[model samples]
Target chain A: MKSLAELQAIKDKMKDKVVLREGTGEIRVVVGMATCGIAAGARPVLNAFVEGVNKENLSDKVTVSQTGCIGICQYEPVVEVFEAGKEKVTYVKMNAEKAAQVIESHLKNGNVIEKYTIGANQ
Target chain B: MKELSLNILDIAGNSVKAGATKVGITITETDETLSLVFRDNGCGMTKEQVENVTDPFFTTRTTRNVGLGIPFLKLAAEQTGGSFSIESATKEENPGNHGTTTTAFFYKNNIDFTPLGDVISTVTTLIMGSPGIDWVFTHTYGEKETRIDTSEIRAVLGDDVPLDSYEVIEWIKSSLEEEYDSFYK
Candidate 1:
């Protein structure tokens, strides 16, 4: 029951924030979407990141993409955030709700959610 | 995958990796069945490769020992009491190099077949990830139908517009949404 008018309004309102991703130092959020990841619920997680970034108006600052196996099938539905210079942060066992939290706390607030990070266990 | 659109995306990603310059996707929803077809002019698999593609233990990638996309799709189809198939001719197998075709059909009455997810996202993501690849998408329901060709859009927008731009993406999404909206009406 969604409408195109809604999407058009978003395009008009955020016209200025479009970031040309060519070395703009934009943050990259990659979802592991290979066979394992997809089977383990990566689609909703990917969708969450995409919708969250757009809703939060962080599209210019963050790029959402998908990648092949991250070599960790047990921790399926993995999401990795790569900032300009910081070490990449990998979040495992992610779901849609947790993805929204990542977008809000880590991406917007500039504070990594340590509890969700790969280092949480370490 | 929990959504049919997501499965389509994953399977099409394989076509992209096969060095396909173009991928044609067809979705037809009728009163009795929903069918999906993906045809790609890519470096196709050999018979041996095709035989093992649906096996969870087999994969061509060294990064992982299992390939789940095709196998999952097959399971989904069978679970719905539908059918699935993939056929391809390797470049060397033929002179003109006909490529791969993957197809799936699900009975409309089947409860296990996942509903088509956000198709607009699946399509735009395909275009964004593989720039310069032409995508011919066709959707049909009942007597109504719509077709979108990326090549045509590119011609209209010219070089001044990047296909992945926010405006372009919204435009494509809106157009598709509009078409589908009218179909259901």
Candidate 2:
């Protein structure tokens, strides 16, 4: 079990290092976390994004946060990626495996994973 | 919703939105039964309110409700050869102090148990992921049982955020599945 003191420490350490909402050159990865989203496994998907970014050393360039309902309950566990200078890509029905790919190709290499994107499904 | 877990999340969200400080969720499984009970210390509803909660048309929030959450929970429980119930009590000291508790139970042989694992995961994940909310979850598989305390995790993570990050989510998922699978098998 992790503790709150540790999180505060991390937050304290992060205060000067990372600006949360600057939206400058940072890559934003947003996970839908509403009731519908969580039910569809958003928690794991969120985790995968955090881990993938941290592991690949893209923590500074990428920021992950959660949002409320997307109103598309059927296609939940949704993740949206907004790069510094690209169109926003929304991925639906995401799991951990798919999230990893998003981190690698889309977040890091600037290539979207077509099959996982909303446009591909349509 | 398509998945039962979604329904649980929706209902639990209601409890939080209602100003609930503590929520209790229990999942019980036996050779003959499986059940889910969600109890919240939020505002209790009147008889009329309770009756209309499942109507899918009476929403307190301007966000457009149709009361799908509770009704969905009721339907899920019934489809599995179980039943649903809601009870509330008005606070005597505090005029507006009240709470509502909903319980949905399913008998094992009544509905397909294929989704049982998913349901458990959904509820556990939702409870664990939310912060400032105290939840006690109990899972019983025949004679084997376990309980998770969100406060313990909260103690570790502190007040900055209530949920564990992605790494913690994976750890929790595997840990829960490992515990439940032992009884499931």
Candidate 3:
């Protein structure tokens, strides 16, 4: 079992990392979390984004947040990525694995993972 | 839900959606039963609303018109030979007050009862996720017990220190884990 001591360590390590990224980021990562989204297992996908962004040290460039339904309940857990001045990319039926790949390929490398996008399914 | 903490989050999210300023959550474990209760000073439901909540098709959220948190909780408890219930004090009916209370009992000794998940995660996430809302959480394991009230944290935090601040979130997690340790460890 994990302990309080571990949480303390995380704070000490993340202080400068999270605070510095407060407003300078232009890339937005949004996870849908309405009842439909949550029941479809969006929690892990959301956690993956929060942890993955911090792990990749992209907090300085990306902002992670949650939102209610995007009106497409059947395709949840949906993740949308919005870059400044660019069209939003909606990724449907997401899981932890795909979230990780998005962070690595799209967030860090600047190349969108096409198959994960809504267009791929359409 | 995979974990009790997630269930807590889901239910509390409903509290938040209902416009609750203060939410109370209690968890107890004994030789006979393991139970959880969530009470919130939010918008209380009508009798019709409460009765229909068990019908998987009912939902208040306009997002997609589906609700499952309460129904699943009722099912989870009943499946284990335990019981589940919901009570509400509607302001319209009561005149002076309003809120919703949900309770679930799971016989600890039952073969189908699920294990209590990481509760530290439960309380911390509740606080971290909703900085504006106040939370009171009580946990009991056997004869030992622990209570955490965010108002106390708020008094120390003052106005400038946000509950969602990096350090505060860390401290809340540490303190909650320590408290849980006192009961179970």
DockQ of each: 0.28, 0.25, 0.24
Per-residue lDDT of candidate 2, residues B1-185 (tens digit)? 55655666667777777678888878777777767777888876777777787776786756556446677778777877788888775464345647888888876676453355365556555654465688776777877876666776666555443344444455455556666666666
True contacts kept of each: 0.22, 0.22, 0.12
Q: Return the DockQ of model 2.
A: 0.25
TM-score of the candidate numbered 3? Answer: 0.84
Q: Count the backbone clashes (under 3 Å) in each candidate.
A: 0, 9, 0
For model 1, how does the per-residue alpha-carbon lDDT over B20-124 read when each residue is reduced to its tens digit?
A: 888999999988798999999999999999999999889889986778889888888888899999999999997497689999888878888788878877887
Q: Top TM-score: which candidate number?
A: 1
Query: What CAPRI grade goes to candidate 2?
Result: acceptable
Model with the higher DockQ, candidate 2 or 3:
2
Model 1 C-alpha lDDT versus the unseen true structure: 0.81
TM-score of candidate 2 on Cα atoms, chains taken together:
0.71
Sorted on DockQ, best first, the list reads 1, 2, 3
Any runs in candidate 2 off by more than 4 Å, and if so which?
A: A1-28, A33-51, A54-65, A73-77, A82-89, A93-97, A111-122, B1-6, B44-47, B65-67, B89-97, B111-114, B156-178
lDDT of 2 by residue, A2-63 (tens): 23455456555544443342334478888887656765788779768877887897766787
